[model samples]
Target: MYKILEKEDIAPGEKLYVLDAPDIARKAKPGQFVIIIIDEKGERIPLTIADFNREKGTITIIVQEVGKSTMQLGNIKKGEGILNVVGPLGIPTHIEKYGTVVCVGGGVGIACIYPIARGMKEAGNRVISILGARTKDFIFWEDKIKTVSDEFYITTDDGSSGKKGFVSDQLKDIIDNKEKIDLVMTIGPAIMMKVVSETTRPFNIKTVVSLNSIMVDGTGMCGSCRVEVDGKTKFACVDGPDFDAHKVNFNLLNDRQKVYLKEEKEAHKKCRLEERISGNK
Candidate 1:
C-alpha cells in the first residue's frame, strides 16, 4: 500500500495526488505512467506521472475522476493508501534540445503534457505550449506550464477563456507564423492527437504522441495495450505510451478505448448506487 502524501484539487474532477513512492519517483521519467488498481478487485488504469520529486520521495499523479476506479480513488484522503501504484512504466519521453518544440494538450491531458514540456525546457529547448478545454473552468496548470514554456496559449470551446477555439486552431496559427519549429508533442484524446499530427504533418515537423492504451499490467505481458506503429504491433506499456504520431494507427486506438464501454457504464452505476445506499444513513 502506497500512502497518499498530499492531495490537491487541480481542476473540476481532476486532482493531484502525491504518493510516498520513493522507488517509482526516483526511477520515473517524463511521459511515463503508473497502473493503478484501487483495490484487489478493481480494474487497472494507467495514469501519467504528472510530476515527481526525487529527493522528496514522491510521485505525483494527476487524475481526472472520469471513471469508477478514479472516483473511488478520489474519495480517499491524504493519509489513505492506494492499493496498487506500479510504475515509472513504459518508455520515458525522449528529451533533447530539438530547437523549437510545440507541445499541445487538450482537456485533462494538460497534466500529462506538463512534465514532458518541463523536461524539454530543461534540455535547452524553446517550448511553446497550447492547452484547450471545453470551458475555462476545465483547464488547469496554466502557471505550471507557463513556467517551462517560452510561449503559452489557452483555448476553450465556449470562448470563456484565452482563445475561443480548439487547441488545433492555436496550433495551426503557430505552425503558420512561427519559424523553425523542429518538433511537436501532443497528448489528448486519440482523435485530438490525430488531428494535431495531421496539422503538423503538412509542415513536415516531427510529431510525437502518447498512447493511452487499454492497459492491465504495466508490462508487455498483457498485450491489452497493443498498437500498430509503422505497421508493427507494439505494446504501449513497455514499448511506449509514446510513439511517432505519423506512424500510429489512430482509428484502432479510438476503438480500443471504447472496448469496455458497457462494463465501464455498469461499473460507474454500481459505484454511484453503492454510495447512495451507504449515505442513506
Candidate 2:
C-alpha cells in the first residue's frame, strides 16, 4: 500500500497529494506518469508526476475530480493508503540544452508541465513557460513554475489573472516578435495542444506534446493508449506520453478521447448521487 503523506486542495475540484513511494520517487523523471488504483475494485487511472523528492521518498500528483475514480481519490485523506501505485512508467522527457525552450500548459496540464520546465532549466536551457486556464481560479502553482522559468507568462479566458487570452495567443506573439525559440513543449487539453502545435508548425520549430490517452494497464499490453505519430502507431505507455507535435494526428487523438465521455458523465453523476445519499444517512 502506498501511503499519502500530505494532501491539499489546490483548486476547485483539484487536489494535490504527496505519496510515500520511495521506489517510484527514486526513479521518477519529468514527464513520466503513474497508474493509481484507489482500492482493489477501483479502476486504474494515469496521472502525470508533478514533482518528486528523492531524499524524502515522496512523489506529488495533482488530481482533478473529473470522474468517479478521481473523486474517490480526492476523498482519501493524508495518512490513508491506496491499493496500488504502479509506475514511474512511460518514457521520460528528453532533456537537453535546447537553447530557448518554451513550455506551454493549460488547466491541470500546468501541474504536469512544472517538472519538465524545471528539468529543462537545470539542463542549461532558457525556459519560457506559458500557463493558462479558463479563469484565475483554476490556476495553481504559479510561483512554483515561475521559479524554474527564465521567462513566465499566464493567460486566462476570462481575464481574471495575467493576460486575457489563450496561451497559444501569447506564444504566437512571442514567435511573431522574433524570439529565437529552439523548442516548444505543450501539455493540456487536446484542443489546446493542437492549437499550439499549429501555431509553431509554420516556423518549423521543434514542438513536443504530452498525450493523455486512456489506459487499462501501464504496459503496452492493453493497446488502449495507442496513438498515431507520423502515420505510425505508437503506444503512449511505453513508447511515449510525449510525441513530436508536428507529426501527431490530433484529429484522431481528439476523437479517441471522446469514446468514453458519455460513460464518464454517467459514472460521475452516479458517484455524486451516492455521496449525497451517504451524507443524508
Candidate 3:
C-alpha cells in the first residue's frame, strides 16, 4: 500500500495529494506522469507528476474531481493508504538550452507545466510562461512559475485578474512583437493546445504538447493513448505523452475522447451504485 503523506483541496474541485513513493520519487523527472488506483477494485487514472521531493521520497499529484474516480479520491484524506500507485512513467521532458522557451498551461495543467519551466530555467533557457483559466479563482501557482520564468503572462476570460483575454491572445502578442521563441511546451485542454499550435504555424515556431488521452495500463500494450503525429501512429504511454504540436491532428483526438464519454459515465455510475449498495448491506 502507498501511504498518503499529505492531501488537501487546492482549488474548487481540485485536490493535491503527496504520496510516500520512495522509488518513484527518486527516479521521477519533469514531464513524467503516474497511473494510480485508489483501491483494488478502482479504475486506473492517469495523473501528472505535479511535483516531487527526491530527498523526502514523495510525489505530488494534482487531481481535478471532474469524474467519479476523482470524486472518490477526494473522499480520502492525508495519512490514508492507496491500494496502488505506479509511476515515474513516460519519457521525461527533454531539457536543453533551447534559447527562449514559452511554457503554456491552461487551467489545472499549470501544475504540470511548472516543473518543466523550472527545468528549462536551470538549463539556462530564457523561460516565458503563459497561463490561463476561465476565471481567477481557478488559477494557482503564480509565484512558483514566475520565480523560474524570465517573463510571465496571465489571462482569464472574465478578466477578474490578469489580462482580459485568452492565453492564445497573449501568444499572438508575443509573436507580433517579433520575440524569438525557440520552443513552446503546452499542457491543458486538447483544444487549447490545438489553438496554440495553429497560432505558431505562421512563424514556424517549434511547439510541443502533452497529451492526456485515454490511458489504462500506461504501458505500450494498451494502445489506449494512441495519437496521430506526422501521419503516423504513436502510443502516448511508451512513445510519449509529449509530441510535436504542429504535426498532431487534434480533430481526431477530440473525436476519440467523445466516443468514450457515454460508456465512461455509465461505468462511473455503476461504481457509485455498487458502493452505495454495499454500504446499505
lDDT string, candidate 2, 27-136, tens digits: 99999999999897899999999999999999999998888899888778799999999999999999999899999999999999999999999999999999999999
TM-score (all chains, Cα) for each model: 0.97, 0.98, 0.96
**What is the C-alpha lDDT profile of model 1 across 1-281, one tens digit per residue?**
99998999888888889999999999999999988887888778789998899999998888889978989888888899989888879899999999998999998889899999999999999999999999998889899899999999999999999999888989899877867889999999888999998998877899999998899887799788999999999998899988999999999988998999999999999999998988831
Estimate every model's Cα lDDT from 0 to 1.
Answer: 0.90, 0.95, 0.91
Give a tens-digit lDDT track for model 3, residues 165-271: 98999999999999998999999999999999999998999999999888989989978888899999999888889999999989989987787799879977876
- Ranking of all candidate structures by their lDDT, best first: 2, 3, 1
By TM-score, the best candidate is 2
Candidate with top lDDT is 2
Q: Candidate 3 — worst ten consecutive residues by lDDT sum?
A: 272-281
Candidate 2 or 3, higher TM-score?
Answer: 2
lDDT of 3 at 35: 93
Candidate 1 — what's its lDDT?
Answer: 0.90
